[model samples]
Target chain A: AQSVTQPDIHITVSEGASLELRCNYSYGATPYLFWYVQSPGQGLQLLLKYFSGDTLVQGIKGFEAEFKRSQSTFNLRKPSVHWSDAAEYFCAVGRGSNYKLTFGKGTLLTVNP
Target chain B: DVKVTQSSRYLVKRTGEKVFLECVQDMDHENMFWYRQDPGLGLRLIYFSYDVKMKEKGDIPEGYSVSREKKERFSLILESASTNQTSMYLCASSSHDRLIPYEQYFGPGTRLTVT
Candidate 1:
């Protein structure tokens, strides 16, 4: 079955430090991948998506993700972390043109000043 | 900006009470979905509607029903609220056009607690 996995339950980073959140997916076909961030008590906001073409995709709030097909990974990265960047991040996968999404449990990010 | 709104941010109810959780989307989306989020488990789809009066069972549809009387509104019903049913409920909507990769827009979730 198609599924998404976020290995990290929580990650803490110092302000201005580089950040990376890992995601892995298992699917038969070329998958549609996405990253979403949710602040406490708020709905999820789309960060980035990868469907086809360039493996590297850029998202809002200085976030970027790379889709590595060989590794079955789509990892989110940020050059520098801000206090406001602290939030829960989820990785999701969709097959073909379907809208149904399978989401990872999520990784809670904490930024310490 | 796409706007999806849920009727409540927090709700508490007894175990046997019938519960209604409402969702409305301003975007004329053809597809709407209901999901529950727990602490360790990610969001699990409960039900979805493709069009008015059309519904499909999602991965976890037991103990839950849905109503989509109008295009812009979808409601999730809990037949008999149980403590195990206490969860953060999220509503989402997206366009159905196959050409455009559907991007789901989410509403602020309603935290339901069944006692």
Candidate 2:
């Protein structure tokens, strides 16, 4: 079975500061990874996805993720986070032919002024 | 753009009452899923349907049932609502296209409260 682990339960960063959210996955073979963000009382929106090729994948809202095969990690990073970037982020792993995904516990991000 | 819409945004139902959550997708997606989101738990799938009249049990489907009579609509049912089931219900749909098969588009979600 595939599983995702997000070590940080909550993260707080000031505006204009760079941010990185760690995500680790346990899969037997090559895994499809994704990052999703959810604002207060809103549904989840896909931040980015890693399917194949280029280790560095860019996503909407100036977010990017690096798929490191050796470390089994797909961490999300942003050069400078705005106050609007504060939200809950989730990491998910997709395996096999099925379209199902196993998601992590989630990391709540707070952007401080 | 794929759009998924749920029937309700906020629902308050009494315990033991039957609850129905409806979801519809604009795109002709082959898969639709129902999930519950909690504080610590990101999202747990309860049921999913790949096609019309075809349904599959997801990770947590013990207290849930689903119906998919139409290709664009999926319904999740709670036979008897319990306080434990009170949470944010999310509906999502994804295409089976080989090019981009794994991305799921989600609805705004329905917050259900059982009292």
Best by lDDT: 2
TM-score of chain A of each: 0.97, 0.98
TM-score of 1: 0.97
Minimum summed lDDT over a 10-residue window in model 2 chain B is located at B95-104
Candidate 1 lDDT over residue span A6-113, tens digit each: 999999999999999999999998888899999998888899999899999999999999999999999999999999999999999974555788899999999999
- Ten consecutive residues with minimal summed lDDT in candidate 2 chain A? A93-102
Which CAPRI tier for candidate 2? high
> Candidate 2 on A1-113: residue-level lDDT in tens?
89999999999999999999999999998888999999999999999999899999999999999999999999999999999999999999985788988899999999999
**lDDT at position B92, candidate 1:** 94
- The TM-score of predicted model 2 comes to 0.99
- Which residue ranges in model 2 land beyond 4 Å of their true spot? none
| Candidate 1 residue-wise lDDT at B32 | 95
For model 1 the local lDDT of residue A34 reads 91
lDDT of 2 by residue, B1-115 (tens): 7789999999999999999999999999999999999999889999988899999899999989999999999999999999999999999999899888678999999999999
Q: Please report, as a value between 0 and 1, the fraction of native contacts recovered by candidate 1.
A: 0.55
How far off is residue A98 in model 1, in Å?
Answer: 4.0
Each prediction's Cα lDDT score?
0.93, 0.94
- Runs in model 1 deviating more than 4 A are none
